[model samples]
Target: MRRWTPFVLLMPFQFIFGLIYSWGTISPAIHVQSGWPQATLDLAFSLTPLGLLPAVILAGRALHRLAPKTLLAWALTCFTVGGGIGLLTASPVAFMLGYSLLALGVGAGLSTAACIALVSRLYPQRRGSLGGALLALYGMSSVISAPLFDEINRLIGWRPSLAALLAVYAAVGWLAWAFLPEAPAAPGRQTAPLPLMVLLRQRPLRWALVIVLMATPLGSASFATIGHLTKAIGVSSALGVLAVSLMALGNGVGRLGFGLLADWISPRFSRAAALGLNALAALLLLGVLHGYGVWAFVAYPLLIGLAFGGMAGKLPALAAHVAEHHGEAAFGLLFGAFAFASFLGPFLSAGLGMHSALQGLALCALAAMGLGLAVAR
Candidate 1:
C-alpha cells in the first residue's frame, strides 16, 4: 500500500489544485462570454478561496471520523457537480454557487491538505520531501493548464474545455479509488488539534500568517492582473498568458526547492529567503513601472512566484512546531489567509494603484522579515 498509494492519489489532487488558481487563465473568457464587469468576475473567481476557507476548517475537524475513501468521494462529487453547474449555467448566481462547491471539494474537504496528510502518514520520515513533491505537482497543473486553457478556450471554448477537464479528472479519480489504500496512522496522529486561540498565539505561526497576509497581495495582484502587465509593456496577450505558465513553473520549483531547503537547513532560513525574494520582486515590479525592459515583465512572475510559493512550502515544519501533531489543521488556517489576499490584492491595486500596491507589498515583506529580530521570551 505504501509503495504506490502516494502515486495513485496524486492524479486527482493535481486536477483539483489547478482549479483553485485557474481564475487568471479563464477569467477573461468568462468576462467575454457573460459580458460581466471585471469586478463581478473577480468576485466570482475569488469565491474559490472564500469557499475553501471554511470547508478546510471543517475538514480538519472531521479528520478523526472521515475515512480517506469517504473524504475522496465527497471531494470528487462536490467538485464535478459544481464544475458541471458552472459549465452549463450562463447565470451569474448559478456560476458563483457552483464555483463555491468546487472550492468546497478541493479545500480541506478532499483537497491538498487531506491528500498531503495521508502521504505524511505513509512516509512519516520523508514527509517534507513527499509533501513538497505534492506541492510542486500542484504547481505543475498551473504550468500546463494555463496555456492549455488559453488555447482550448480559443478553440472549442471554455465550456468544452471545462467539460474535457472534468472528464479527465473523473477518470483519474477512479484510479485513486481503486489503488489508494488506507494509510496506517502516524505514531502520534491522535494528538488533539490546538485551540484556534492558542494556535494564533505561537510566534512562528503568527509571524508566518502575518507574512502571508502582507506578502501575498503583491504576488496575488501580479497573478490576477498578469495580462495587464504584458499590455503595459506593449506585448501581445499570448506573451501575457505564457507569463502565467512561467509563474506556475516558478511556483512549482519554489515550493519543491524551499521545502527541501527547510529540511536541509532550517525553517527560519528558508522563510527569510522567501521574504527577501518577495521584497526583491516587489522592487522589480517598481522597476517595471518605469519601463525598464520587457524582460522585467517576464522575470516578475518567475521571481515572485518563487517567493510566494516558498512562503507556503517552507511552513510544514513551522506549523508542526507550533501545533505539535495537528500540522494539517494548522496548515489549514494558513491556507485560509490567502482568501483575504484575493480581496486585498485587488483592493490595493484599485485604491493604491499599481505602484503603491507593490510598495505596500514590499513594506509588508520587510515588516515580516523584522519579526525574526524580535526577542522571543
Candidate 2:
C-alpha cells in the first residue's frame, strides 16, 4: 500500500470515531423510547471508555501482531454489530443491550490504535503535526455531528437515526478498510519492547499516566450528561446540543492551539494553563451556573472543552517523550489512564445529582491542577 493511504482512510475512521459523544444528542430520544432515567442514559455514555480504553490496550498490543487493516476490520465489525443491536426495540433491556453493544463499537479503540501506530511509524518525522491533525479531526467530528444528530434525531427518532448513521458508517468503513495499510517498518534503532508492568514501575511514566487519568474526563462526563444537566438547571434539555457544538469548537481549537503551543513554548506551561482552565470551569460548576440559567451553561462547556482539548493534544506527545522508546508502554500506561478516566467521569457525573456531581468534579479538577503543576516542575 502507498504511504498516503492511511491518511486518506482516516476520513472514514473520523465518521465513526466520535459516536460516543452522540449520547448527548440522542439520549433524550432514548429516554422517550425506554423510559429510563437520565443516570441510566449516562451509564450508557460511560460504557464507551470501558470499551474504548480496553480496545486501545488490546489494539496497542495487537499492532505488533496484526495488520492495521485487520484491526480496522474488527472495529468496523463491532460498529456494525453494535448498531444492529441498538436498533432492536423489544423492551427496555433490549434497548440498553443495543446501546451497550453500540457503545462497545463506538468506543472501540482498535482502529484508533491501528491508525496511530500506522501513522507514527510511517511519518516519524512529522508525527506530532500529523497526530495533532488527527486529534483536531476527532474534535471536529463532534462539532459537525452534534447539530446533524440533533436534527436527525428530532426528525426521525433515535433508532432510525442510528440506522441512517450505520449506513453511512458502512459505506465509509468499506472505503477505509480497503485503503487502510499496515504500519511500515519503523525507521530507527529498534529497542526490544519492555514489559508494561516494568514500565509502570518507573516514576516518570507512572506520573505521566496519572496526569492523563485525571485530566481527560473533566468536561466529557458532563458532556455525556449534557441534556440532563440543562434540564436540571431549568433550561430546555435540547439546548445541550448547542453546548455540545460549542464544546467541540473549543476542543478543535484547543487541539491545534495546545499542540502548537507545546511545540513552541513548553508542555509544562501548556499543561499548567490547561489545568488552570479546568479549575476555573469547576468554579463555574460549583458556583455561578445555578443563578444565571442558560448563559452560565455557555461558559462552563467552553472552558472545560478547551482545557480537555489542550490536555488531549499535549499528553500523547508527552507520553512519547516520557516513555522514550517504549511505544507500547505509552499506549498501555498513559493511554490506559485516559480510557480509565472515560469510565470514571460520566459514571459519577450522571450518577450524582447535577449540582453535587458537578461540585465534586470541580473539586477534583482543582486538586488535579495542583498535582499537575507539581508534576510539571
Candidate maximizing lDDT:
1
User: How does residue 92 of candidate 1 score in lDDT?
Assistant: 76
Each prediction's whole-model lDDT (CA): 0.68, 0.67
Off by over 4 Å in 1: 1-4, 100-109, 147-156, 186-192, 230-245, 287-299, 373-377
Residue-by-residue lDDT tens digits, candidate 2, 295-330? 666688788888877776665556566666756447
Model 2: runs farther than 4 Å from truth?
A: 1-5, 33-40, 88-99, 102-107, 146-157, 187-192, 224-244, 265-269, 284-298
Q: What is the TM-score of candidate 2?
A: 0.83
- Weakest lDDT window of 10 consecutive positions for candidate 2: 185-194
lDDT of 1 at 190: 73
The C-alpha RMSD of each candidate to the native structure, in angstroms, is: 3.2, 3.7
Query: Residue 288 lDDT in model 2?
Result: 53
As a whole number from 0 to 100, the lDDT of residue 70 in candidate 1 is 62
TM-score of each: 0.85, 0.83
